[model samples]
Target: MRAYTALINPISGGGRAAERWEPIARLLREAGAAVTVCPTRSREHAVALASSAARRGEIVVAVGGDGLVRDAACGVVAGNGTLGIVPAGRGNDLARTLGLPDGDRELARLLLDATARAIDVLEVGGVVVPGNVYAGIDSMATAVINRNRWLPGALLYRLAPIRAVLTWRPATYTITADGRTRELRGQTVVVANSGSYGHGLRIVPTARLDDGMLDVLVVREGRLHRIASFLRAAKTGAHLDLPEVEVSTAREVALAADRPIPLCADGDEIGTLPATIRVLPASLRVLAPTAPRQSR
Candidate 1:
């Protein structure tokens, strides 16, 4: 039997993950498996636990949301071990990309069989991201949303961008993608592997995880009414048709601005620009369903 480490973030999903870990662990053990449930004391702790277990060639399963997934993925990728996800996080955006099943029965089946698929990763200034890397107003919005965790997750996520655009000033952004350089004043810039972020927003609707390239998107600064319309269209992915929106594909992207701007990957703030983001193609082995499902 393959040994497994379930890295549980107790505080994720409003503490629901911690409360639910016992049964999940029991289920794995009952199936004739070696299951070790590791409750993460902190993000750094989760990294250490996962890294140590993965280095020993154990399957490291992330049992929380995107943040925990990112940490566990870092460890698994470093050790070249397999990664599994439980889809218990708030966004579960990475799970959405992987077409991961939400039910416990399906999850157990997946962990046992351990179907492996190579997926692309993003390296933003040194932080490893399994999903998307973004910056500018949206990143600022993420930072703001983190501070107001008392509100419901969905409401806070949707409102943060609107609040941010109202007060956030547009900056002149210089972006070089695959050696082609361009400068524009935009509200946000995104390079995606799975293309989804900000609580189900299809920020890059056409991005593919194994494409060996990143989908680069830039939402240009515009009048308030125009920006509002752009956002509305973005909700349904219709914003791609707007003239102010530019989409392209690249293997690497470097972003810089006149002022220091924060950057985020999979919703966690990594650092500020000027920074280079590159695609590490087919780098991490992810345990996904045997049969493919529609990308959400």
Candidate 2:
């Protein structure tokens, strides 16, 4: 029997993680796996718990959203353990990227098999981000989502951008990718490892977790009236066709702005501008399907 430790964020998905994990835990136990449940009090606590369990040669399962998954990955990397994920958060972006199953029975079966796949991760200012790191208006929208936790997940993610755009100001952004620099006046810049975020938006359609490169997207400053259309286009990755959008791939990226602009990764605010992000190739071993479903 495999030893597994589940680090669950009690309040994730509007306090639905624990409720969602119950059936999965029961299934694992029925499969004869030794499953240990740990309810995380905070992000720091989740990391610590994951590290300790991983050091014991146990599979560390993150049972929450992308934020919790990032924390668990940090600890698992430190302890050199394999990772498992259960999608019980508002934005299961990483789970979506890995093509993890939504149903409890399917997820439990996948967990029991313990199939591991190596994937790339983003290292930004000493933090591990499994999805994408973004700045400008998207970061502001993340701030708005964080403040209004009472709203439903999809509703909050959809409305936050509109709320953020009301006060957003364009910034002169300097982006250096693999030492090649470019300057642009933009409202959003995204360095993506996973193609999808904001519940299911295909922010960068060409990004892949094992690609060993970062997909850098710059949304050039445009008329405020175009924001809604751009967002709608982003859902199907059609925004890349817009003249204001630019996409490229690089191994490392440095971002700086004329003024302070907040940066957000894996659904949490990391820091401000002048940040350096690099891809750690094949750094994470995750229990995922043999073939990951790509975002359109």
Candidate 3:
């Protein structure tokens, strides 16, 4: 029987992560797996717990959202252990990218029987991000979401963007990708390892987890109406067609702004630019379906 260590965030998804993890844990135990549950006190605690468990050759499962998954992944990478997910948090973008099942039984089955696949992750200042790293308006929205955690996920995510857009102004950015540099005034810059974020929005539709490359997207400054249209189009990945939108692929990306601009990974703000982000090719081993589900 395999040994598993689950690090669960007590307050993720408005206090739902713990509630969701119960059934999953029961199922894993019933299947003869040795299950250990650790309720994480904070992000740093989660990383520490996962790292210690991983060093013992136990599969470290993050039973929360992308933020928790990212934290656990950092520990797994540090200890060189496999990572698993239960997707019990708001904005479970990484789980969506890997096509992890939603139901408790299916999720437990996946943890027990799925094949581990190697995927790329973004590294910024020693932090491993399993989803996209972004700046500008989207980062602002992330701040809003963080502050208003009491609101429902769908409603909060939708409203935060509108709040951010209202006060957002275009910033001059100097972006370097694989040594190629460009200076532009833009609303946002996203470097993606996973295509979806903001509750399934296809921000970088062409991005792939195993590609060993980062998909860089820049939304050039536009009028309010045009920006709104771009956001709507982004829902289906049609924003790539907009003239103001530019897309490229690179192994390393550097971002700097004329003024201080916050950068976010997964769903939490990391720090202000200038920041250097690199793709750690095939650095994370995750328990996912053999043939992964494609993001729409």
- Candidate 2, residue 282: Cα displacement in angstroms equals 0.6
lDDT of 3 by residue, 57-122 (tens): 999999888899999999999999999999988889889878888899999998999889999999
Q: Which pairs of residues clash in candidate 2, taking residues 3 or more apart in a chain or in different chains? A: none
Off by over 4 Å in 3: 292-296
Residue-level lDDT tens digits of model 1 in 60-84: 9998889899989888888888898
Residue 184 of model 3: what lDDT? 96
When summed lDDT is taken over every stretch of 10 residues in candidate 1, the lowest stretch is: 287-296
What TM-score should be assigned to candidate 2? 0.97
Q: Candidate 1 regions off by >4 Å? A: 226-229, 290-296
